[model samples]
Target: MRNLLILGAMAFCLCVHVCSDTQSGPQGDTTLPEEDGVLQLKQEHFKRALRKYKQLLVHFCKLHSDLSFKDAAEALMGSEVKLGVVDVTQEKDLVKELNGTSYPMVRLYISGDIHNPVPCPGVKTVLSDRISYFCTNLHRLSHLCFFVQELTNAYSQVFHAAAVDLPDISFALTQNEEVSRKYRLSQDVVLLLRKKLDCRKHFKTSQILSSPVLNHALLFVNKSSADFEEISSAFSSAAENFRMKILFVLVNVAESRNGRLMEYFRVRDFEAPLIRLVNLTDHVTYHLPSDTLNVEVIQEFCQSYLDGKAKPKMQSEPIPEGWDQKPVKELVGMNLEQVAFNPDKTVFVLFYLPYSKASRTLFPLWEELAEAFRQREDVVIARIDASANDINLSTQGAYPSLCLFPALYTERSHIYIWRKKYLKTEN
Candidate 1:
């Protein structure tokens, strides 16, 4: 019911909000021409987001004016679409109102008080500009707030929709009480909020298949008796269209009610991973039994999943820095190609860009690897440029070809290489 509807609405809104043009009003009259130009530039920047940017700015010059804000608030009163317009006139207001230090800040606050807006920090600038860039840099606290807001908003709508009684929903900054005194959330409310936000959503039909990174239930299962093939096709189409990772979890009656999907693609039986649960097995042991077959089981399970250690599938491949070591066959252009590799020796290759900021930031990482294996004779590191390669490597293709040979060899020399890991690492 509500869960299904909220699911549809969340997906529809998120997709539309990301893909479609945002509601940008004309730059109203301003005192300074610079402000006017900046507004226009900001609009252009937001319009150019190539799917990486989730939060886009919708300039509401009218929003800043008292009369305009009041008018917009009235218009939004009966409308289904919600808008959050943040005003940053004073430094104290910026800190207290937005819980942030950033300026010219705009946040999307769904179903919350406008005065107490939660930060949404992953929002990036579509273009480079000094002022806009300065206003968008996020602090660590604000980043956590953004993630928590997103996580809780999802929970408040779907899994917690049918709660007979609403539990307190808040969050704390630290685990220990004596650590510090900043940004601490109410304990009881935080506990419930944490639980609801942690459990993943399940749907009966495989209509949409996007998975949530955090614990929360989302309805992707189609309830209508659609054909199994059609449902699978719908899910695949949705996933492909949205460019998201989605999967289906089938619940089993026997064994653990908590089933989790493993890296190996198997859904193993586990305890339920939710906040509160009513145990069919027990009625008297009510001190919030830790192992009770209630919502807490789901919570514990999700916590475990989030904290679980990952098992390495293959050996580590660390690529070396500075370019190819030896002169060899020509194929260099703007495409990527596998240079060489060996099976016996430890091998790693890094794809680098000469002029890119991202590459420059990664130079230190290469230096660290070089130092670690500088004296060691067992490991081999290689570097390639994505911009200056011989054969044209597909942007959709994988990267950093790593080859391991049977014996030690000179730089750029290799006996053989595993083709799969080399390709995937490029991305």
Candidate 2:
């Protein structure tokens, strides 16, 4: 079933195509024409569009198998926003220049500045949801508050409130006709207030355990629907109050579907109505007190967890086989930070396509470098298969690209020193 789902998703991605109106250019030149809707961006028009629009959302994807790109473009179609898509396969130079080795990468360019772009959250199927939420909440939170009065006056008041930082809230007036029609707004005008931090109540094993977001995950493990409902209600109330400070997740241990996670968390058969707070960053767990669950107790639990008073029970995962035995450390999404950002050591990472001739050709060079640096305590060498790792290699400019990363302990922040010496060789 899992394999079938994976294949289905792959099929969906394979069907994505460049817009029909997209114009092709010479070998190195890609042209992007001015279009009102989603602009099919090429190398030539990428930077120009960023400079023209105050807020631009660019989707870097291949011509095929890019379902996320299509979904994001469709969701933001009617909004007064500039949306663009880049076919990474067609413009390899541009992709390399931007360090965009990951498929279906989304970036937000604000105020024509290209040096630092905010990465769009969520991946694969959830891309559209995250993009919609971000678009709705960009700059400040937006709410669709209805007010039956002069439209201009309401907008002015909201603008003034946002400008003066009053009410500790930001506001925007969306008078776009298309947006109004899409949302079915019958009134002449409405105030859009920002929403509170959107929290995930029901979590799957994949999302909760793998997400990089650092938060105290309060999991309510219950069997009965009545117990689940009561605890969920209390959790929702507390979650809104704490909003963004913690994550509340509900797990039905009774369901066979969640059996694996239950076992992983070590929830005994008798511990159905139990609650566990997990801190993924530190790999710590805290069990709830034996007393009945309530809003007050849950709040106290969160407060105590935040205050670092709760005793931490360690959670461990068996290291992958041959992890520490490799000379060129294989980089994955989970271990990227632990290796790349080591405070005591400088890391030299090679980003390459595993099967490519160029990558194979450079393997010996990297191995030799790793061997030379093996005894150096302050320096580490690593290599990442660009195809296997979906992480953003922000400084990588080409396949088999070498990037020297400074130690985190250095006063200067992480900087990528790109090496083009090896890339000059023919594949």
Candidate 3:
């Protein structure tokens, strides 16, 4: 969902529409000749653009973000928005300056802290360039610092509201002389404070299993399966419409205590953010089918459920007899959550297609992998038919793949499954 204020597509990669690659400047450099609408930026250019475009939409730090901002670029083309592009790899200092922290999961959280921020390039900001400059640069001349310092306080709230949805990031500005000197600030600079916070620091682990959430016949569980500071602010906005009708709840799947909720919905192996609706009255549950979710998707899911049109999610296939008879334990949708994510067991799963020759060839290797851990109750080597079940693993579209779900679970230990190359015939 795009927040018009920051156009904050939280947790989404930006897709910018680059009309032409034929238009570029200097080979082997992060430079592009100034196109009227698309300004290629440098350190000097970036700072200048910040001042020039009060509502600038920049495409810098082009790893996973800029590509999806095409629509954003197109939408804001001529209106109040200014456009610029920066390749962050070539501008490491710029990223550091903006306080951009690249999480290992690849969910780059640009500080939305108005004092600092994150973005398609670095972080998107609504603060005037003058305020941002004055806040970050303590080395500026005396009078220049004094004039802009007054302007900073006026719009602090406006900027904060825009960034309110950002996951656990905060900002501060300092005018203290000692503070400035301690940090070696420029004679003319003001300091902005920054602090990283854990959003779930005080949340009770047992809240999900509580009676209020489960007993409510119509419930919306908006969960972030990724282990990061998740932003569920969009749901709050979505919740406004259905006030008392559908009780909306938030769940963090990363915590070990919340694993039961994931298993309860059979979404333990699913990787994307999940939106599940439970109707205790009907003794059934429905989950949002789409991989990508937005405010619109959430509303539709809720409306359909209330209207009795939404279909219940697939719980699991019937357990296959002799499922664990062989060395390579077989998994179906029913038993996947129980086995694959066992905190006590180090599980290695080979997701394969039965019809593929490559998958058939991996059987011996699979057996060997299982045989190696046969004596230990802790390690389980298993396989599942990628075609037969509704497992929502992040990796897909290929076969004979391996994923190790380790016993020592942590954000780092989670499987970063490789996407296997698929044969044309299979497609």
Candidate 4:
């Protein structure tokens, strides 16, 4: 885990302990004193908030620390600037509340005793990003709380570290129109970084886009409804970025209605090898603002996306040669020493038991060749009864079939023999 600088902590601690700190570097460190009866924030607490704000702070506050925002905003009745935590454990109720409130409700909506959903989005985010976003938009607490709760859990898995909890930090939300617009922009950026990407694992800008074996690129859009033709043209250069095989997986956070647009743009149903689509919402869109992103959820989301579920296969055939062997080694252990003795010409030997039905048929034919070829100098033949030994082989498919290379054993020069007659077609 990386070390994070709290509101006002030693600068060195934040730098040296950045094991999981995604947002690196030091930004401006500013603070204001408690002049009036309003709550006075400690320097340590303020630094933590500053770091979070600079790195993950989506909105910029025009009113500096000395501007006295709380007193001024309260005086303006039509202001859109808001600062506070919004609890959205009751998701529908919270939305209803926001519908009536003024624009830019800077509430940090926390999950307050609400019904959970499937694949509960794990927490994988670092502490700084979550708190920075949380504190900055405290006025929209309900939106923040609802979204944060889910994102926090999801991010927890990615950072694999604890967030510096700011239980004491307070924010002031107002109805300032300019502040609201700025906050919206900042929120969009935060969502882009937090939701669309697994910042801990994804390739950075340093990685080369064009290569012979594999090529990769990242495409993002403001909304899911962005035109497909525009996107295709925008990324056209990337299509020619590789030589051999190019694989593209588009990741986006869009409205559910845009699902069809994504499917059409990516040609998802055809399952083309060159392009793919992944919806970030499929993982944690339902999360409220206050919900923390944790590492566990990050791991599960990553694992599920990277490792697709295995499906059951229906039986296609009855019995085939080499199907009975549980493992290839079981069939290779038999009569190995005897097969090694033939060095003049290549000896194609099979190791199988006579009792197995597939082996029973293959062993007799092999025996006839062994007898005929024993006196010949050009070829040698042999068989091993795997059943006689303790080796296990799978009987689900083909069995007793000659393998090309069985465990690369030194017992025989080759596992399968081919006659010159087979080579006449190659020339």
Candidate number achieving the greatest TM-score relative to the actual structure:
2
Reference-based TM-score of each model = 0.21, 0.41, 0.29, 0.21
Off by over 4 Å in 2: 1-52, 57-81, 87-148, 152-213, 254-260, 268-270, 314-427
lDDT tens per residue, model 4, 185-277: 433122311222122233322232322334233343333353644554434434333223333334443435435544533324222212222
Q: Which numbered prediction scores highest in lDDT against the true structure?
A: 2
Give residue 208's lDDT in candidate 2 (0 to 100). 61
Between candidates 3 and 4, the one scoring higher on TM-score is 3
Task: Note the Cα lDDT for every prediction shown.
Answer: 0.33, 0.62, 0.55, 0.33
* Predicted candidate 3 versus true structure: per-residue lDDT over 123-163, tens digit per residue: 23432232342233334333222212332564554443333
Give the poorly placed runs of model 3, Cα more than 4 Å off. 1-300, 303-312, 410-427
RMSD of 3: 21.6
**Model 2 residue 149 lDDT score:** 35
Candidate 2: deviation at residue 414, Å? Answer: 29
Candidate that beats the other on lDDT, 1 or 2, i.e. the better one: 2
lDDT of 2 by residue, 1-427 (tens): 9999999988776654332224332323434563445677777777877876766777787665534344555665554446787888798888877767477787776677776666665333323443234323212124553333344575555554443222223333444555556667677555454565555445555556545556755554665656777776776677876655676777766678777667656776566676788766544568777568788888888888889887654333333567657777776655766777788889877777778787787789889998988888788788776654444434434566666667865333343332444233221
Separately for all candidates shown, the number of backbone clashes (residues 3 or more apart, or on different chains) is 46, 7, 25, 120
